[model samples]
Target: MKLRRFFCLFLSVACLGGIAQAQDDAASLQEVAQRREAQLADALERLRTLRNDIEAQQIPLAQRLQDLDAQIRERQREVERRQRIRDNQSVELDTLRQRVSDRQRELDYISRTLLPEYFANYDASLSAGERATAGEDVRQYNLFLEKPDTSETDRLQHSLALLRDSWAQLESRLGGKRYAGEALDPEGRVISGRFVQTGPLLYFAADQGELAGLAEETTALNATVTPLSTSQNAHIVEVAQAGRGTLPVDPSLGNALAIEQTRDSLTEHLEKGGIWVYPILLFALAATLVAILKIFQVYRIRHPQPMAIHDIVKALRAGQRDEAMRLARSQPEPAREMLVAAVEHSDESVEMVEEVMYESMLSTQPRLERFLNVIAVTASAAPLLGLLGTVTGIIKTFRLMTVFGAGDPKPLISGISEALITTELGLVLAIPALVLHAMLSRKVAGVMARLEKASVAFLNGLSRKSLNQKAS
Candidate 1:
């Protein structure tokens, strides 16, 4: 029994020991689990931290990429805009270049062609200062054209300035006015005078009447003035002093004045009137003398104051036949002669006395109408002579034309002048001669009528006296 109880005690001790070891093992296991949990918690915390760091680094990269993308887009748009701008600028540059070329061509034409012709024709009309200025401008313009170093802008500016100056000068010259200057006369005398200018025409008048005339520019460079005439000097002076007088004006500006300067004298003009002009003048003189003599004869015959028909009739009615005859014989005229013939035949029969008076009238009519026929013939012949002169002149002109080949007008001028002047003189002679002849014919008719009336009155009175004596 005691051995069995010891074995149980040992068994019980073993059990106790195992149970304590098991409890200890359980506590150890619990401690190990707690350590593993702590390790895992630490590892999870590290993973979260790493993930946050990665997200942060990736965010910056994404922002940089977005910024880069935006920059690329903006650069592309800028390139497109610059291309458009370049295209527009190219078009504008081309247009501007074309305009510049056109302007250059216009400027060249003005410089080369127009300026030279204008200067050649109108340069003489400019004043001395203006001429010098314009000449300098032209010289510079020519230099600019010839020189390669001159800039286009500078050339254009200079050309514009020259054009403005030229236009101003031309305007002033065309607008006429008076100015004071020195003038050279035809007699080689220099005179200070007031000058009147109209375009190219210029005239000068001195304070004294001795120097006044038209002037022409002899030298363009020094503006030397030369006179055209002294013939109208006094008239020009009068006009200048009075502001209104018979002053000569150049109708053809300078052309007619130049022709007048070379015109022939009066004697030369008459000489050009040809040989027919002398006959025409002689006819005119003869017609004039005949007209005068006829007028005197008609006046004496038609209206004799002492032997008037009324006075002769009164003396005959009072039986003063001798006194009547004496009054009739006092005047030496056709009417007086007719009255004397009637008085001498008053003692005859009425028919015989009428026949005697008719014979006397016929004799006086011839004398009255004698020179009038010559005047009439001259009047008719003058125009014929003028036509003959015209024909002769035309023949001469044709001859000159044939000889000279119609090249020069000077050769034809003489013949033409002769023809025209002879015609003019012939017309002058013809018109007056015709008028005088008509007047003389009318006067002769009137004188014949008056003489016939006086002779008829005498015959009637004598017939009445003869009848009264026969009745007694």
Candidate 2:
């Protein structure tokens, strides 16, 4: 029991030591908890201070960020706007390129078409003296055009040179210019001469002051001039040398000299009228001759005088048969013939008298109308002949065009002249023939009417005794 009691006492002492240690541990815990509470309060205050500082800084930062965002949007929009401008510029560049291409095409067309035609016409229109200096340039220009693969640059250069030269020549010549050149004399001798160029006319005055006249161009493009009258040559020499005399004044600007120089004579003009012209001229001649004959024949035709017919009727009514017959004889041939028949048949019935008068009229009508159908035929045929000539001329023109093309009008000139001349001749012949035919027909009708009136008067003037005797 004693041992058990000692163990109990020891257990109690250990238990009491454990309880004191536990109480000390609890106080240390309270102190540690107090220290931790103070630290927590300090941490909470620091957190509140940091949150206030962050809120104050964040306002300006948010405003700065929003401003940056707005600036970025503006820069993006500016970039888009610039891109659009670039796109428009690209379109404009394409348009410019297209315009350049079109200009190039136009240049090519001028070289291919306008240049050749202009040079050809220029050579045709200028006198040989004026064209002599330009021949080389024209030849070279034509060569360039004919070359299939010629560059545009070469063509442009040649065209500009030719155009400038032509313009300069025209400008200088229009106001009258003098130059030295070689010309062919009437005898085909080459002579040195001073050339005076005035518009389309070129005059060559010899250096020796001998031959002077208007300069003409040959098919070979040589300048040829024949001498004028002695006085005229002297005058032209004076004008060419001294530069003080008047050229022939022209009302048609400066074209009259050219026209006068190149004027075709009647024979030359007729020759240019081609093959159809011969027929037209023949018809015109035939019509003229026929018209003359018809005029003479119709104008000389005799018709009875009114007074002579009246006297015949009075005699017939007065029963003077011999007097009536003598009056009928005094009248002109056609009226006398008809009246003589009526007087002879006066004792017969009226119907029989009428038949005899009608027969005489029929006989006389052929004489009055003799060759009248020719005049009518001529008037009707002239215009038809002209139309035929015109058709033939047109056919010739087409044939020439087929062979020579329309580039040179000279080849076609003959056909055009023929067409126009034939039509003009036709109209001229037809109009006069128609007028002559109308006048002749009127004359013939007047003569016939006079005969008819005399016949009627003779029938009315028949004696009643003569009629009653016929009835018996």
Candidate 2 clash pair list: none
Root-mean-square deviation of candidate 1: 15.7
TM-score winner among the candidates?
1
lDDT accuracy of residue 346 in candidate 2 = 70
Clashes of each: 0, 0
The residue-by-residue lDDT of candidate 2 on 312-405, one tens digit each, is 7677667787998988887778777888888777767777988999999999989878877777787888788778878888889999999999
lDDT scores for all predictions? 0.75, 0.80
**Residue pairs with backbone overlap in model 1:** none
Could you tell me how far off, in angstroms, the CA of residue 330 lies in candidate 1 after the best superposition? Answer: 5.1
lDDT string, candidate 1, 1-472, tens digits: 8999999999999999999999999999999999999999999999999999989899899999999999999999999999999999999899889999987787777665666565545454464434445666676666776787877677667767767877876676576555666666666666676665556656667766566666665553433343445657666665556655555667776677568667989788889978877887788788889888888876665355533666765676678889889877874577677778877876678899789889999998998898897789888988888888888888889999999978889999888887888887778778888898888888888888877777777777677777777897
